[model samples]
Target chain A: MEKIIVCIKGVPKPGSIKVDPETHTLKRENMELILNPNDRPALEMALRLKNTYNTEVVVISMGPPNVIPLLKYIYALGADQIILLSDRAFAGSDTLATSYVLAKAIEKLSPFSLVLMGLKSIDGETAQVPPETASLLGIPSLTNVKDLFMERGKWIAIREMDYGEEEIEVTPPIVASVSPLAFDYIRPPSLKRLLEVKTKEPLICQVKDLNLDPQRLGLQGSPTQVIEVFEKKIETKGLVLEGSPEELVEKLIEILKDKGLIKF
Target chain B: MFEKIKLEDLSKENILAYGEFYKGELNSSSLEILSPLKEIAQTLNKKLILVSLIGSLENIKDWEEIKKSLADEVWFVINEELKDFREDLYTEVLVKIVKFSQPYGFFFPATKIGMSLAPRVAGALQVGLCAHVNNLEVKDNQIIMARPTYGENIIAKLISKSIPIMATISLGAFGIKYGEKEPSIKEIIFPEDFVWKSKLKIRRFAPSKKKPTKLSTAKVIVAGGRGLKNKETFQKLFELANLLGAEVGATRPVCYEGWVEEERMIGISGVTVRPKVYIGFGISGALQHTVGMENSEFIIAVNTDKEAPLVKIANLALIGDAGKILELLLKNLSK
Candidate 1:
């Protein structure tokens, strides 16, 4: 059967992840991890395609060993196969290095017709991985994809651009990054599927499993290094005006006029 | 055939900026990077070359702006094959050009095309790229890039270990100014053996029927949040914006609520706008939403909660009902 690969990430629940006030660094440990909000649409799209086209939906994640539960949870959501790529060697990989590892994993699962992913992770929010990975795999990437369909066995995707929308027709072995704006509802977990997945485990892969160059696996492979990270504090002219809505509106109008924003 | 420059012989000294010339007009943001890049180039004693790939040479109408950009040189790869952007082919040609030019750094505007194209070129070259860079500094001959991460709550300073420190500059991060200079021009011809076809093809593109949002370029912005309640209440913000001749923006929640198009969402996940004046209605000022508009010259926020985070930083914080305030503001402005 033809296969579609959906790359997902387990991220901290929104507003649950906290930053260290003193060090200005993220405190990622011991936090609740949920499927990345952005990845929901990607998984949903893959599952829909699976239902419609009879394609196999293979979901892959790259994170720590703790990511297994998330993978198991995804399986309950209708993924045929779940794979976890976890290793100390994979730690601290930036977008490029991370995409390299993902591309390698995708290559290992060869003959797959499509690769799908979220345009940006909630934590990182750098919509770079999909394109970078596609480049490494020597395939075309359509990112921020709002809509996609198969026409006569050809892939047609409508992507959201800064200016407008673009419709593209692409060949197979292509990667697409789904936009969060595309799909709002991710199917809830089915009780029967969840119970079935309790006994199912993800196929785990470490550095030794994949034929990866040690020099290109983790921090050592990363080209950009974060020298410092700090909390951004904004200082503005604090002025509070409290009164009736009409009074406040009148004050604002006067201010706009003073600033030459409004003409008489 | 273009002469091949070997990687080993590359000096990696000059600075290069990607000049986005699409259709007939040069992107203003591409020119904006030149102001800061000019200073860096002067300090490093390196030539500042504006590199561009164009579909046709005769269609170029922004040559006057290029001439006054203070760039030391111009490099153009003019070909009919480039008429439509093909990611693979463009990445291949750009990788070849970077290999030949051997620049110490390359800057691209953080735009739709740049965001997509820059990473692919960086991937092909196996170089590090800092995305959405807010600022840059040259320290000890290394380009240090600063960018926001973690939902715009934290700013990270980074340095690239690889040559040709590539970065996509954030929109409106740098302002543009003209300097009189006659830059030498060079045209590049692709190698004879480089004839290649891309697997990706454009079926069609229907430009937005609505007027281009142009939020990034708007001098004034009137934004709304969930505090405005349902769609009907939110619609009043547009009337207020129209009277003020300002663009409309939204917080993530409001956008998710389907009050506005995703493009109008101003926050970490959406567009970052730094307008001359910004007014927010019913916004409680989450960091995710505030980061995108914090750089505005002046801010007026109308929220019921006086202690809201955005209220504390606003130039004028009006504590009142969001819907009521919006209604009143619209009535006053439309008069």
Candidate 2:
């Protein structure tokens, strides 16, 4: 059977993660982790492809050992196999280093026809890893894909552009990053499947298993380094106006006129 | 005929700025980054170079306009096969050009194409790339780039350790400055020996029903949030926007609720807007949404909760029911 690989990530649930007000550093201790919202579309597309072509859908992620449960959850979603690439060496990997490692893992799972990933992870929001991984694998990448399907043994992707949309066609051995909003809804995993996968251990691969260059694994392989992290402080005029809705509307109009926002 | 000429000067390093054409015109975002690049090049005392990959200069109607813009030199690499943007082909061509040009730094606008292409080229070149950086500065001979991360709540400063330091800068982050530079245009065609075919092909394109309103450039924006209650109330925000001749924007929750188009979402995952006047109805102003519009010249927020984050940062905070206020504002504006 043909193979399709979907790259997913576990991100901290929004609002649950906090930043140190003083240092502005991320506070991750005991933070709740959830599947990246953007990655849901990619997984949904993979499942659709699986149903259409009877292909085996493989899910891959690069994160800590604690993310194993997330991988199992994906298994319950109908992924034929799930692999976790976790190691100390993979820690602190930037987008470039992360893409290198993912490319290496994809290489190990060679002969796969398609690789799917989210347009951007909500946490990192770089939107660079999928294309970088494709470059390393010497394959084409279509990003921000709103629509994708197979036609005449060729894959068609309709990518969202700034002003419009462009439909593109490509052969297999390609990478495409999906836009989550395009999908109306994602199917939830069944309770029975979740219960079954909970007892099964995910296949974990460390740095050494991939035969990656030690220099290209983690922070050492990362070319860009975060020197400082700080909160962006925006100063605002603390002026509050309290009145009836009609009175407030008149005051707002007066202010708008004062600011040259309204001629009347 | 293509010439295999190589400039082998290892001592001199120049700043390379990527220029892009959108829909047969020069993308304004691509040119705006040149203003900052000009400063960086001057600070480093290096020549500012503009590089473009094109199928033909004839395809770009504003090629002459771009050629006259501020740059020491403009290099246009042409190939009939390079008509459309194929990530694989573009990355291979760019990596080769960067290898030969040996620039000190490369800058790209964080457009849809740049966001994808910059990282691929950086990966192939084995270099570092900063994504959607809002600011750039030179200190100790290294360029420090800063970008918002973790839901735009935190700004992280980054530095590249490798040369041809690459970064994708946010659009509209810097002003566009046109200076007097009669740049020498260099046209290079790929050699016949370099034969590569793109596996990807452009099938077709479907433009939007109407010309999309870009919230980033709008002078006035009337935005709504979940506080609007339902789709009917959200529709009123558009009516008010129509009366005010302003663009309509929405918070992430509003977009997720399907009250507004996702493109109009103003938040961390959405478009950053810097309008002259931004008025929000029923917006609680989560940091995720505020970061995108906080830079507006003036902000007026209407929410029942005076203590909402959005209300706190707003220039004029109205402590009242949002839907009622919106209706009153609409009536007053129409008159």
True contacts kept of each: 0.80, 0.82
Task: Please list the C-alpha lDDT of all candidates, in the order they appear.
Answer: 0.83, 0.82
The number of the candidate with the highest TM-score is 2
- The TM-score obtained by model 1 is 0.92
Query: For this target, which candidate reaches the highest DockQ against the unseen true structure?
Result: 2
Go through the candidates in order and give each one's DockQ.
Answer: 0.68, 0.70
Tens digits of per-residue lDDT for model 1 on A1-264?
369999998777777767655444455556678888788889899998898889999999998777789999899999999999988888778888999999999999998989999888878777889999999998998888988888877898999776667898987879999978787667987899999998999999988888899998777899888888876675546799999888998998898998788887
Off by over 4 Å in 1: A18-27, A260-264, B1-12, B267-269, B332-335
Superposition error at B309 for model 2 (Å) = 3.9
TM-score per model over all chains: 0.92, 0.93
lDDT of 2 by residue, A1-264 (tens): 369999999888887767655444444445677888789889999998899889999899998776777888899989999999988877668888899999999999988989999988888888999988998888888888987888888888899877578999889888999976778878899788888896788789998899899898667888888888877565546688899999999999898889776785
Poorest 10 consecutive residues by lDDT, candidate 2 chain B: B2-11
Clash tally for model 2: 0
User: Which pairs in model 2 have colliding backbones?
Assistant: none
- Writing each residue's lDDT as its tens digit, candidate 1 over B166-207 gives 988877667787777777777776666777567778888777
